[model samples]
Target: MKATIRWAGDVKFEAESGSGHTVTIDGPPDHGGKNQGVRPMELMLLGVGGCSSFDVMHILKKSRQDVTGCVAEVEAERVDEVPAVFKSIHLHFIVTGRALKEAQVKRAVELSAEKYCSASIMLGKAGVDITHSYEIHEAAE
Candidate 1:
């Protein structure tokens, strides 16, 4: 519910969450950063991906799906003018499992986007054109 961002010099910062987790954030060299860590915007996108992926995996596991691996690829567009912000974002989930049910996969994705994944919901409410799609890969029997 709370976090802190402390400057670590030259456009770099250390962000810590209330739960004691921390991550480094920095800008590109052109913006005076040393490129030591992920960009702020990149972190935002990553957060959303992580959030949704977590939900999907949890839901699938609860359904007794033999989940093997999962990956989320996210793409976003930003405004061209000053104070640039994300205008749209798309998430593609690639889920791998043994005999994974297509309907279950679809339902998991839907549950995350519509019921869970607070990050995506918040961004969507902010007018970001957030969209989701998914592919399911069955593992070799």
Candidate 2:
């Protein structure tokens, strides 16, 4: 529930979480960075993906779906104005399982988007166009 960001050098930082996890953040070299770590913006988007993915996996498991793998591909667009905040985001989830039920997958995604994923809800409240879709793939034998 808490984190701290410390400046490592020009355009670079080390962010530590309350759970004793650390992540290196940096910008591109053109912005006085060494490109040694993930950009802060990228991390934010990835957090959204992570949050939603966790919800989807948990839901599927609880539903007794034979889930084998799940991948979330996130895409976004930012305005050209200063600050360049995200304008829209689309999350495409590829879910793999043995005889995965489409309805179950759809329901899980809907639940995450509408109720569970806090990151997506926050971004949507900030006027970001958030959308999601999923494709279920049959697990190999």
Candidate number achieving the greatest TM-score relative to the actual structure: 2
Clashing pairs in 2: none
Candidate 1 residue-wise lDDT, 1-141, digit = tens: 999999999999999999999999999999999999999899999999999999999999999999999999999999998878999999999999999999999999999999999999999999989999999888776
What TM-score does structure 1 among the candidates reach?
Answer: 0.96
Against the hidden true structure, what lDDT does model 2 obtain? Answer: 0.97
Q: What does candidate 2's lDDT look like per residue over 34-83, in tens digits? A: 99999988999999999999999999999999999999999999999999
Give the Å error, residue 23, model 1. Answer: 0.6
For model 1, what is the error of residue 12's alpha carbon versus the real structure, in angstroms, after optimal superposition? 0.7
List the global CA lDDT of all models. Answer: 0.95, 0.97
Give the clash count for each candidate.
0, 0
TM-scores vs. true structure, each candidate = 0.96, 0.98
